[model samples]
Target: MHLLVTGFEPFGNDQFNASGEAVRLVPDKADGHRITKAILPVSFQRSGEVLAALLQDHQPDALICVGEAGGRDEISLEVQGANVDDARIPDNDGAQPVKQSIVRGGEDYRPATLDPEIILKALHQAGHGAYLSEDAGRFVCNRIAYLAYGQKVPALFIHVPALRPEGQKATVGAETDNREAALKAQPRTSCTLPELAEALTVVLASLADQMK
Candidate 1:
């Protein structure tokens, strides 16, 4: 099976976005299925356009989009996307969408393809904490997660965190800028970039096995 994976460019409040690092490291670290990768601009306004282009360009058998869901501490497999858009924070373009569907009036939402039960089980067996997220959140993560299912291909959106680079804190900060605030407050995630890439490999390999 062919897998198209996406990770976002670092955006607001985050200096250590691991998604990009994870996706970039995939090809070198591990593989069973073909992994095509793309780095998404950190703008909600551009997400659909980029995703559409990717669908047209690669047309992979399965799509796994990874996004930084800052506050989450575990591997979260999103279950469903809310049709309505309500951004608690503005996107990279400074646009805040609220009370409107991701698609103004196109179609309803669909769930993820990687079995929540199966994938979560595997992650735990591999000694990585995991869970099923009720909300993908009303951000670009949700936007692409929603779009993936409508494409008639197996699709999933995995939310990762802003892991502290050296697994240590600055230990000296009086004021918290957006950067500092994100570092301490969101706590990114605990997993390393290399670990995430390995997990994606496991996911794709399992998916292919299930298909066979």
Candidate 2:
């Protein structure tokens, strides 16, 4: 099976996104499945465009979109993607849509094709902190998932917790001092990049087994 796994770039006050870093660490292959990984922008409009292009180029059997969810201690296997774009803060391109429909005349909710319960069980057996989450939020992460659902492919969104401070390199810019400080000040549950990568590999393997 071929899998197209995606992660997001840094947004808001975050210096680094755990999802982007973790996807970089994920192996090229898992359980006889070919994996193509890409990092997406944190923009509502651009993220969807990029994801659409990737889907066209790769045309994978399954799609897995990963994003960083701060304050969440466990890896989240999202079950549904609401067709809403209510951003608490502006995205990377400074576009914040409030109560906007992702696709006009689309369904209010799109259920994920991947079974979160089965993936949750696999993660537990592998000793990873994971849970089934119904909400994917109304940010860019949810927007990508909502767009992906229209592609007629099996799609799932996984939310990874923040990365440990040591897991990401400090940004080298005097201008980003305040943003860096703010990121450090936020109280968040974090995990190592390796840990997230391992959990994602397990997820891919499990998904491949399910397809068989």
Indicate which candidate wins on lDDT.
2
lDDT of candidate 1 vs native?
Answer: 0.70
Q: What is the per-residue lDDT of model 1 for residues 1-212, given as tens digits with 9 covering 90 to 100?
A: 67788988766665645778788888732345777899887666798789889989988887888876665667778887656555656667988776678777766667776566777777777777778887776667778888776777778888776555774532211111123343465444567778887787776666666555
Candidate 1 clashing pairs, residues 3+ apart or interchain: 162-188
Q: What lDDT would each prediction earn against the true structure?
A: 0.70, 0.80
- How close is every model to the real structure, measured as TM-score? 0.84, 0.89
TM-score of 1: 0.84
Compared with the true structure, what per-residue lDDT tens digits does model 2 show for residues 1-212? 89999998887766788889899999999977899999999898889989989999999999999987765668988888888887766888999888899999899998888788888999999999898877777778888877876678888899887664654533311111123343453435656789999999999999998788
Candidate 2 TM-score, true structure as reference: 0.89
